[model samples]
Structure formats: structure tokens, C-alpha cells
Target: MGLRHKKASAGGGHSTSGISPNSTNGTSGTSPDISENRPSWRRDPLEYNLDRSWDINAAPTTRVFNLTSSEIQAAPDGVLRPLFVINGQFPGPLIRVNQGDRVLVNVTNQLSNGTSMHWHGFYQNGTNWMDGTVGITQCAIPPGESFLYDFTVKQFGTYWYHSHFSSQYTDGLVGPFIVHSPEESKIQEMYDYDQVVLLQDYYHDLSAALLPGYLSSGNENAEPLPDNGLIQGTNFFNCSSYDSDSGYACDQNSTRAIFNVAQGKRYRFRLINTGAFGEFQVSIDNHTIQVIEADSTLVHPVTVNRLPIHVAQRYSILFHANQTTTNYWFRARMNDYCFSDQNPVLDTDVRALITYTNSTSDPAPTESVDWTYALDTACEDLAPSSLIPYDPLPAPQVDITYPIEISFQIGDFALDKAYINSTTWVPPAIPTLNQAVAGLQVNNANFTTSGVSTAFDSSQLVIDVPTYKVIDVLINSLDEGAHPFHLHGHQFWIMASGAHGAFNWNSYPTLNMTNPMRRDTITVDAFGWALIRFKADNPGLWALHCHISWHMEAGLLMQFQTRNDIMRGWAVPSDVLALCHVK
Candidate 1:
């Protein structure tokens, strides 16, 4: 099945409105009139929530969203720089829909560079071209052009959309995409309010300006450090930290994000880490949070004082407003131990205000005490074994095993690059999907291979599944840094993971096949290994790569061509094909 483009205008579907602070009982009341004339960075908190009158059991309808990408100057953390924003918002607007609803997003690229929008964690089963991956699915939406991303969301949980071209998303161009389902009715009752909490590692310079240095010879594997951390795209940065002649436009008027909650009400905060490099250890002072979902996979509630979240990963936690009516600190501390080098001007501890009375005052140190538990010293995800899927679904028996090793090497010109089994991926001139469909339709032998395909150049790592089967991917990281790997179009059951060493063949039979944590993104610890299994049921060219903006740009990516029997019949939409031929 190919993607369908609708010719209707961009404003008819359910649109979001601002949340009124005067509302009681956690239900939104009298939405404030929001328009383009308002401050660009200001977003309505209610825009992130499912409408109170929305009927979860109602029929799914097509939701149309319009986004304009442009370059603007803004100081998310006191440092002014050129940023790529959607609809003038640093963090893009929310695209909320119900499960099975067709989502049509019109992305108008006004920047001088090419761009594409990847809906993170969506199973773009039949509409693979709409996956919006630059190299694996389709070409980038060229400068001053528009592309309509059309796909139906099959899963319901917290997901996001971001630019898939190079490190463009690091500069901005990211936002939340949420899908609600009737199946969530039971979980909905557990909370009276719902909102999104965006956590990102902020950089003072544009990613385009920093890329050359990181990719320069002799630089080794030292990733550029973040200047600050942000909560909801805003944070307090001390302008005095910069020298008077530092050449930066620092504004001391910047402030931290504040989230207000009513007493005795439970709120669900869906946290998404949209950063380039840093992993955040998130916590709310005096609040013991319960994690209900991870990477769009709902799980049995796991309570913890702090949450360790890596790049591109998401978690939804339930927080109860049972404490005193006062402001408390919500902390997202970057794991500096994971950084290869220290940044002197960086404040690793990023904070936001969580108030019960809508007071914006900073919490007194003695009023809100942090949990005594030590932060995570290692860069990795929360243990997979500790989280069990809410719905018990046994993993299918594995039919094959594919082992791949990852490492960063300084080769040739002494420039550093990442590799997956001796192959460092670079975007092919034509997307892999285009090449596969064209070759498969003509019965080319190179495209029909069961293992790795030779239809593309050496830089393209293409593993062809070709048929339906259950597969286990053993990902062993040889480098000394944690990597959060995201698999497009599918969520896998994490059979086993370790901080160090190889998968034990002796322990293979003892693995948990029933109800293991299933998620779209997982962090393989530094020099660690992870064995994940998934059924090769989705027909398309699916990308499996590290979600870190730096790592991915360094050639750490691969694609799986699954179920060619169905893909062989695809006819890519003309609009998607037109992007490649743009002058």
C-alpha cells in the first residue's frame, strides 16, 4: 500500500487551544485565545492534553496539521542563536490523535537547507514512504518546498516527531506527537491531568557550525558538550558565566519552566528527551514518581525516585500532589560522567518549578529536599528487567540471529567515524526504499538477497529479511559510551542486556520470553551488549540506528528490508519522488 495525499485545506481537524490557569479540578476551562501575534516561544499547556470532551471510543478521523519551518533568533537559555522552529515555536506544536486515525502533516520547509520529518516510534507499516527518513524511506523536503506526511498511527502512547536530516533536530525542529486509544481508558483514570515535559541538552552554537570541528582530524571521539539543559524549551542561564567579549548575546531575563498542579490530584507527565548528546536523570523534589510507560509501550507501574532517560527515549510517569501547597523543584540533571570532556560554563543540574499554588517563586533549599538516592553513575537506560509490559504478550520463537558490533574508529585522514560491523552508513544518493522497490519490481538478483544486499553502495548497510520470520539482533557496543538505539517501524522485546560482556549462550534458554519490556528505543551501555527480538512482519525499509544526533551523523546507522513480497508491489507517491529531482 502506498501513501495517500489529501487535497483538503490545512485547518479542519481538531486543533489545540491554550489551557486556562484559573481552571479548577485539573480540567481545562475557558481556553485563552492564542494567535501568531503572541510570543513565539509561548505554547498552550492544554495543547499537549487530550481534550476533556474527546470521546476515546469514538471513530477515528483524519487529523490535519500544518507546520512551517523557518530560521529565527531566540534565546532558549539566555544565549541567542539561529534556531529552526516550527510555527515560530522552538519546540514544535503537539500533533494529537487517536489510534487508527490518519495523520496528515504538511511540513513547509522555509530554511535554506533540506529537511525531513521522522515520526519517532511509529509503525509506518503500509505507508513506509511517509516514515520521513531521509536516506532509508524518502528524500529530504528541499529548501522552500512542502511535503505532506501521511500515515496512520497504530500504537497509542507518547511519541514525537523531529527533523531526520543530519543533526538539524539538535538546533530545534522537534515536538511531541501523542496518540490516544480506547484501550487507555483504564490508565486515564489514574490521573486527573496530563501534559508533556520536554527535556533537552542545550547548545550555544548551531549544530552546523559545530559539526566540522567534531568531524575534524585528530578530534577522536570527543562529542561536543552541551552548554545547558532545558525543561520545556526554557531554562535559567547565568549570563555572567560568559565573558563580556564572548561574542554571545546573553539575556539575564530568561527563566525556568513552571508546571502547576492542584492539591490531591494526580498528574501524568509524559517526558521526552529531545537532546543531541546528554542523558538526563529526572526527579521531582519529595515526589516519588511512578513510571507507567516507556517509549510508547505501556508497562506495569514502576515507582522510582529518579528516572534515567537517554536521547530519543520517552517515559510517562504519574505524580501525586499530596505534599504541602508550595513550589518544589523538578530536576533534570545531565549525566556528566557520560561526557568525554567537561564544559566549565555548563550547569549540569537543570531545574523547573512544580507548584501547587501557581507560585513562580523558587523553592527554598530547605523546603524541598532531593531524594537521598545517588544518581546513576553509568550512562544507560533504567534496567529492562525491572519493567514488565502491562499486557502479557509472549515473544515469538526466534527463527534467526543477526549479530552486529558497533565501534568508533579513527581511520584514513584520522577523522572519527562510527561503524556497524565494518560498515559506516552515509545517506545514499537515492533512498534505499526507492532503490529496493525499483530493483525488486524488475526482479534484480541483488535486491532479492536474504542477508545483506549489494544493490546499494558500500556505505549503505542493508540487511534484507525478505520474508516473514522472528529475528534476534545481538548489538554489541565496542565503544566506551552508551548508545540509545531506535528501530523504525517496530518495537522489540528486549530479551537480554548487560553493562559489559557478550550474550551468554548458556543463559539463552533461561531468557524471559513472556512479558519482557517492549520499547522502540533502548540504551546499550558502554562496551555493553543487548539481545532484542522482533517478528519481521512489517514490510518496508526500516532504519535501525543510534538516536544521538552526533552518533547518527557519524555514520552509525543501518536498514532492514523486511517482507519484500509486499514491498515489491509498492509505487512511491509522485510528491515524494519529486523531492529528489528538485533543482
Candidate 2:
């Protein structure tokens, strides 16, 4: 992986890697000295523009955007810090493109370090190289380099893009992506307005600065607890929580994010947990939330007062403003049960103001109360069986079953790292994708016909399918902490999951063939198991890994090479191949 290097120069001169956003090399690097030397291909970051008025039935077209990644000075929740943003905006631009359209997003790396973006839930079927995974598919885009991610929107629903590098997204490299289609017309009528709600656990310090200590040998998987939480890039933090000598600037009167609602209107809130860790229970005082979508799959509406959302998961809820004209609290509570310890400055209950009037100055009602349902001690997702996809597509029959045992063990150096079965993943100099393409094209012996190939390094646990096959993956978690496993290219049908000892093979034939919950990310409870199945119709290297930023860095990831018959003829584009020469 090209992720271990640092800036070539510490005492900043003209950076070959590109200038920081807050440095003398301003937003566009307009200075006379650097202008001529700057790459003309580099462009500014894109601005988010999502118009609800746009016709969902409009003809599909190409959507082009230029995104520049750089450092910026900002206060997401009134805590001033250096944030990595796109176009100088926190929580990068929202990408909205209609279904069946082509999206050409050119990303320019202006940060002093390298980074790559992963489209959270898109099945990059034919365009696997454009999946933007830092190591498994391609190397990290070098500093000051540009990579054009050209892919077609094959599915319609709520999705997101974020830096897939080690703990990079934890620092603030995230934004929402929405794909519209004519199928949304019926659901569009169910809500008066639509909005994107982002709920994340906020940290005052950059993740890069904290990585060293967290990875130290003596640490026992004790993750750094969040100092606060944010709802859509803003929140209220108590300035007095830190003393004057604490070296942190604080504002006592920090404002909270406010959403104004008209009386009797139903608003659809697209909730995404972009946080690296922490599961949240989100709700509005006195309002019943009707969940219609989960990870882009529209579900039959189910009403609840509070909804539990884990890391890398999403849900769209409809709430009607049937209460009286007044201000109410929209609360997001971080479930601290999952953390080994708590931070002194952390206020686990994060709230925003939901006002009926345009004047956000209206004070929220103090008498508001949280829902009576108690938060669970275990970190998990909402029950999968409870959600039924509106479209009702049943899962196909399984052709192959891969039973992966997930556990953690101290390596030879006494450093704890996650392992899938006997092998733990570390990025190779040449990506698995590049290696597969070259080997398959030559009809190498490693490209076996039996659906399992050992062509990659021994440290990687890879399953190779030379042809299309339906896969049943039994992820057995042997660790104490719960894991949210996210598959890169396809949404799998979650056959079943629980904190049981192990999956009974006798129940395999008895599994339901009717509609089951299908999503890209699913949580496997501690010392438990989950059986998920997906059609391995996509061609390319797809990663199945724990979504927790820390767990992923601990080597808790594996890859699947599907449809090698199709990949054998792939001619990897020149620009994608250029990244391997970064060092």
C-alpha cells in the first residue's frame, strides 16, 4: 500500500505533493511563482447542488465533477481543528445523478498525504477498477495527483463516498451521494420534503495524529472514545468542559443545527452514520419515525420512536410534524456501551433543534423527553427480518459457501491484528486486481476452474470464481467486539444473524427462499455469526471487511475475485496504472 509515507518536507517549501488549503498556496494556487508549475489538469473541488425540483423521470445524462482534497481550518461542532474537506467545505459535496447515467468525477489530491475514495454501496460491476478502494483494487492516489473515477450508476438509491484510506475518513472526508430513478416517483409522493441527515461521532483531533499511540503494542483494542457527536456537521459542545490551559479554543454559545418544518408536512430524513465508530439511536421528541429505506433499499414503512444505526449504515425515515407549533429536540445518542472507556469531555447525548418557525433562535422545549425504549447493551443493527424491501426480490440459490472465521491474535511482533481464518491482509506492491488481470490474461495455472484460486500472496484470504456463481458467506466472529462487515461491490441477502455460538449446518437447507433483507453492510455480533448470500456476477476484486476504521487498519479485510472469465481480457486504463509508481 502507498499509505505509509509522509510529506517529503516538514519545513514547508514549495510542496511537490501540492499545497495545504490553509497555506500560502491558496485554494487555487494562484500565486505567480507556482501557477506555471501547477498541473493544468488539477481542478477545484465540486460544490454540492441537489435540486428537489429536478424531474426524476428526466433523461439520463453524464454528470461531471472536480473534487480537490485539502486541509482546512474549521469548527464542525464549535471545536476548532484542521479538517480535510472538498472545495473547502466540511462534509464534502453531495453527488446527485439520475439512474442509468454516467458519473465522471475527477479527484485532485491537494493534501500533503495520499488518499482514495470508496463509493460505499455501488456495485461497480463492469468497472471494478473505478471502485476507488485504496489497496485491494488500486493504489492510493499520490499527493498532487489526479484520478478520474468513471462509472455508470447501475442502481438507484442513497449512497455515499468517503476516503477509504486508514482512518482518513474519520478526519472528515465524507459526503452523501444520491441516485434517482423513475421508480422513486411513487415514494416521492409519500413525503412533503426530503433532507439528508448525517450523524457522526466527532473527534477534536486529527485521526492521523492519534494513529501512532492507538497502534502501540500495549494497547488492547481500546479505541479512543469520541469527544462529542455531530448532526450534519454541527453540534453544541460545552466550552467550559475544557479548562483555559487545556490548549483548545472553545465557544460557550455554540449554535446547534436547526431544521425548520411546516405544520402537517411529512419530511423524509436520509440518515447516514459516517462516523468511524459508535452506534447512534436517533429520534425527534414526540415524533414517530417511519422507516422506508435502509442502505438505499426502500422498505415497507415501519414506525418507531427511536432507530438504531451502526457505523457505515443508512436509513430514510418519514416523520410528520403533527405536534404543536414549537421547538423540539432532534436527538442522537451515542451508544457508549461499545467503548472500553469514556472520555471526560464527551456528552453522549447530541441534540439539534427542530423548530416549526424559520427563526432558529426559538429555544427548544426543555420539557422534551427521550423515548422510553432502552438502548441495547450490544452494538448491532436493527433486526434484518423486520425490514422487507418494497420491490421484493428474493435471493437466488447458493452455488458456493465460504465459511470465514474472523478472529484477532498478537502477531510475531506482539502487535494485535485482525485475521480472517489463518491469513491477515496487507496490501501488496501490485494490487490484487492488477495481478489478477495479468495472470488471467496469460491463462496462468493459478487461475483455476474450481472457483478458488491461490494466485495472490499467502497473507491474503482470497476466493476466486472463474465464472458467475451465487455465494453464501458465513462470517463467524470470534472476537469480543461486534463487527460491521461491509462488502464492496454487491449487496448481499442477510440470510440470518445472531449472537449464537455457531451456525448449524443442518439449517442450511431449511433457509427461507422468500424475500429477505438485502444490504451492503451487516453487523455480526460478538462471538456470533451471520449467513449472507450474494450473486457473484460482478467481475473484479471486491473487498469484504469490517467497517470500523480501527478494525480495518488492524488487517480485518479480505477480497473476492469474481468472474475471472470476464476479467481475463481487461485492459486496465493508463491513469489507474500510474498510481502504482507513486513511491
Q: Which segments of model 2 are wrong by more than 4 Å?
A: 1-50, 361-367, 449-452
TM-score of 1: 0.94
Deviation of model 2 at 567, angstroms: 0.5
Q: What is the lDDT of residue 57 in candidate 1?
A: 69
Error of 1 at 224 (Å): 0.9
Kindly list the per-residue Cα lDDT of model 2 for residues 353-382, writing each as its tens digit.
Answer: 777755455454464566778866777788
Model 1 regions lying over 4 Å from their true place: 1-38
* Residue 580, model 1: Cα distance from true site in angstroms: 0.6
Q: What would the TM-scores of all predictions be? A: 0.94, 0.90
Error of 1 at 348 (Å): 0.9
